[model samples]
Target: MPIDWSPLKEIIDQQNRFVLTSHVRPDADALGSELGMALLLRSLGKTVQIINPGATPAHLQFLDPDGEIKSVHDAPALKQAILECDVHIVLDTSAWGQLGEVGKLMQKSTTQKVVIDHHVSSDDLNAIQFKDTSSPATGCLVYDFTQAIDHTPSARAASCLYAAIATDTGWFRFPSTTSKTMRTIANLIDAGANPAELYTLLYEQAAVPRLHLSGIVLQRVATACHGQLAYTYVTQSDFARSKAHPADTENLVNQCMTIAGIRAAFILVQQPNRKYKVSLRSRVDFDVTPIAEQLGGGGHRQASGAMLPGPKDAALKKLIQLFEEELKKQPPAEKNH
Candidate 1:
């Protein structure tokens, strides 16, 4: 049965202290949805605290109003806040596993747990799970949640949701974007979301070092299976030379897919302790989720990611071999579209 959120209004009405969180390595959708919901709930006279285990990327710093989001790494106070809150809201993330070890703390807390997400395969770890895989982004769900309480979104809320929807849809270019997404964006704009500001903040304001890092990655990109697949790797040396953070590499995989003949793309980022993070993107009907799942990760069919526990070079070689093996099973490409 579909989860009905009508009862959630009553729960929010009775709650005084609310805590908001999202997945680790959060994208704009995760950060935006959490901030939008936090701000909206605060407008309803609720005391809200927003927490995330990871630090917010520099590009996403604008999402937080009053900069109240406390990183779990820096703020010991977050532990107390989570314990005392009457309600806990998890956004964008699908499973408790997505929370990493923090999921244990949430499970032990006395507060009522709720999840608002759009991922197709979350583990439903909350007392109330509100997930709609068809929703363009979690921000859209938060918009609906706000409307349920008859609260008009404030400018800050609109901005956050707008960023969430815009980035998740790849500026309305991705297949997941629908007519409803445009309608929601329009409503958010009318409610005072500044498209120019958001665009500037999200894309235009990118630091030069990030572009340099992209150029380096692109120059080293390799293709296989007659250019149907492409992959790139970034090492610690690249980060050192470019002075870039892991967050700066967020969309690098999509850059590989932009090639006219490439059907799929992969990016491997070498992390400390010999681990490697893999991001995959598919342009055609190819499903990347299975590949991610094979690596103990999950995401959409078109785009997914995973982390491999090994040396970067060895992992990259294994992933390439895996992609080649998968390619051999596919039917020959059709010449005509």
Candidate 2:
């Protein structure tokens, strides 16, 4: 069912000050949704500020070139503003764990709270929620909100949202992409978004260290469960050796899926704290969310992630075991012979 945005509209009409936020280690969808929402609210002459649990990843800083989006810790002065806002809108993620420190502050705020998300996993944040799991990206939900208000995003806003929807849907190649998704993209372009320029900025601007990191990750790829599962890992040492930042690990898991006969893929990237951030991906007929949710993380069926306590080798074993068990539940592939 389509979300009734009338209540949200009413909230916007009644509210003056708004603070926007999203999950930690924010992605294009998260940042894009915040930018899109901020623009929509600001267009109505409402005051808006974008804050998040963490700094915008280095790669995604282009989306917010003005540095308007600030990390919670970086902006101590905004704490009062956040709490005093007329409305607090959490976008892209519903899980409190995903929100990190920002979530902690939100818990104490007496202001009206709202959640706009598309993820299946959620926690009660004591907010009115507008969620559509069918929507490929939270950017889509933001677009729907703009339509409800009959507003066109500015060029920058359009570009941010375009990046959000494009990346989350794997450039419209993911199964989640639909005719409606493309229609939304069309509207964004009509509103002044340039897809080619945005794509080059996003994918083509990779630093040399990123490529070095990718080479290391690719070399470590391994297959198991009769080649039905492919997996890889990036250690903290790998980052040091390659001079790559943690953000460079993005999309490395997808490289695992390039292997023939692989139905599922995962990449474990070691964090500074020695924890492993495991990104899981799968083809049709396989679901990765259950595993992610079990580990206290969540996302879509084909793409989900979790953080596991790590002694690197131990984390790998646990994930491999889980994937092996999940694979057993599926019917065996017929022999080529």
Tell me each candidate's TM-score.
Answer: 0.85, 0.85
lDDT of each residue in 171-218, candidate 1, tens digit only? 998788889789889999999999998999888877889999998998
| 163 Cα displacement, candidate 2 (Å) | 1.3
After the best TM-score superposition of candidate 2, give how far the Cα of residue 75 lies from its true spot, in angstroms: 3.1
Write the residue-wise lDDT of candidate 2 on 1-337 in tens digits.
Answer: 9999999999998989999999998999999999988988888999999989989988789998899999988868777778788999999988899988888888997889999999877496899999998899999999998988888899888998999999999899988899999999999999999999989988899789999999988988999888899999999899999999887887788888988888999999888888889999998878888889988998877889999998888988988888888888765567588
- In every candidate, how many clashes are there? 0, 0
Displacement of residue 311 (Cα, Å) in model 1 is 9.3
- Give the true-structure RMSD of model 2: 3.5
Q: Over 4 Å off in model 2, which ranges? A: 233-241, 268-279, 288-323, 332-337
Lowest summed lDDT across 10 adjacent residues in model 1 is found at 325-334
> Looking at candidate 2, what is the lDDT of residue 282?
92
